[model samples]
Target: AQSVTQPDARVTVSEGASLQLRCKYSYSGTPYLFWYVQYPRQGLQLLLKYYSGDPVVQGVNGFEAEFSKSNSSFHLRKASVHWSDSAVYFCVLSGPNAYKVIFGKGTHLHVLP
Candidate 1:
């Protein structure tokens, strides 16, 4: 079985400050990890993904995530956030080559200037 848990339902960050989002998951074997961002009344966009290779992977918009096999966690980090970065961040995962992704509840991020 594969499942994801996002502890924080909402997060607020000041502009130009670093941000870190917590995420934990449970999977049987090699898991596919992904992070997505959704803007107001918009669709989700891919932030990053991790498969088999390196544990740390970078994505667009200055986003990155680290995969841990022992902890079964993939946490997202941003060096500096902007006001436009406010939105919902979701940690998603899929079973080994299942092609079906399961989305977490999501965390709403509010960026203040």
Candidate 2:
């Protein structure tokens, strides 16, 4: 079975500060990793995903994620975050069979101006 973990329930950061959201996964092999964001009253929107080829993929806005097989982690990062980026981010995983998708609890990001 595959699962994702987001240790932090909430994070607070300045509007212009760089942000890194931690994501740890448990799986036998590399799976399809994704980062999704959900606003207060909206659905999940994909930020970025890493399937194959490059270990890192560029996502919407300034979001980027790196896949580490050794650590079994896929952490999301942003060079500079804006106030609008405030939302709940989820780390998702799809197994090689692609039959199921597992979502993390989610990390709520609060940006202070």
Candidate 3:
């Protein structure tokens, strides 16, 4: 079975500090990785996705994620975060059957001023 784990349930950082949300996945074969952000009262938005090609993929709002096959991880990174970036981030994994996807518990990000 494919699974995604977000070790940190909550993370706090200064308004202008860099941020990194850890994500590790377990799968037998190549899997699709995705980082989705859900605002306070909104649906999940696709921040980035990785299927093939470059290991490092750029995403919206100055976000980027690197896929490490050796480590079985796909961690999201942002050089500098803003208060608006506060939200719940989910690490998702999908196998050949895209309909059946796995989602991590999600990390709640709190950006302090």
Candidate 4:
């Protein structure tokens, strides 16, 4: 079975500061990793995904992550953050079939003014 674990339940960052949201996965076969964000009062949006190819994958709003098979980790990162970035972030994983992804509870992000 495949699953995801987001170690940080919540994260806070000052505007224009760097941010990192930790995530780990457990899977035996092929792993499809993804980072998703939900803005205040909004639905979840895909940040990035990794299946094959480059270890580091980029996403919208200057978000990026690196896939580490050995560590079994895929962590989301951002060079800078904004107030609008204050939202809930989720790390998800899917098998080769890519059905309903298994998601972490979510990490609540708070961007300070």
Candidate 5:
């Protein structure tokens, strides 16, 4: 079975500051990792994904993620954040054969003025 773990339930960062959200996964085969962001009252939006090749993938805005097969981790990072970046971020794992998608509990990001 595949699962995602987000140790931080909530994160706070000052506007314009750098940010990094930790995520870890467990799966037997090569895992497909993804990062999604959900704004208040809106549906989830894909931030980025990882399967093979380059460990780092650029996402919307200034967001990006690095994949680590050995550590079983795929953490998201942003060079700088804005007030609008305040939202709930979810680390997801696609099941084998792409049968199902597992989403983490999510980490709520709060941006301070």
Candidate 6:
């Protein structure tokens, strides 16, 4: 079984500041990693995903994530954040079974001006 863990339940960052949201996953075999953001009264939007090839993958809205097999982690990073970027981020893990996936509790991001 695969699972995702977001250690931080909430994170706060200033506008235009760099941000890093930590995410750790546990799986025996190869796993698919994904970062999704949920805005107020909206469905989850895909931020980025890591399936294969490059360890670091770029995503929408200047978001990027790095896959570390050794560390069993897939962390999301943004060079500079905006107040509008404030939302809940979820780290997800999926195995070969695409239908089945595990989601983290989610980290609420508060961007300060």
Q: Which candidate is the best by lDDT?
A: 3
For candidate 2, list the clashing residue pairs, or say none: none
Tens-digit per-residue lDDT, 1-113, candidate 1 = 67899999999999999999989998887788899999988999999999878899999999999999888899999999999999999999897466667889999999999
lDDT of 6: 0.95
Residue-level lDDT of model 2, residues 65-102, one tens digit each, is 99998888999999999999999999999976767789
**lDDT tens per residue, model 5, 38-85:** 999999999999989999999999899999998999999999899999
lDDT of 5: 0.94
lDDT of 3 by residue, 70-113 (tens): 99999999999999999999999998987869999999999998
* Order of quality (lDDT): 3, 6, 5, 2, 1, 4
What TM value does model 1 have?
Answer: 0.94
RMSD of 3: 0.8
Ranked candidates (TM-score, high to low): 3, 6, 5, 2, 1, 4
Every candidate's lDDT? 0.92, 0.93, 0.96, 0.91, 0.94, 0.95
**Between candidates 4 and 5, which one is better according to TM-score?**
5
* Per-candidate alpha-carbon RMSD to the true structure: 1.3, 1.0, 0.8, 1.2, 1.0, 0.9
Which residue segments of model 4 deviate by more than 4 Å?
A: 98-100
Residue pairs clashing, model 4: none
Clashing pairs in 1: none
Write out the backbone clash pairs for model 5: none
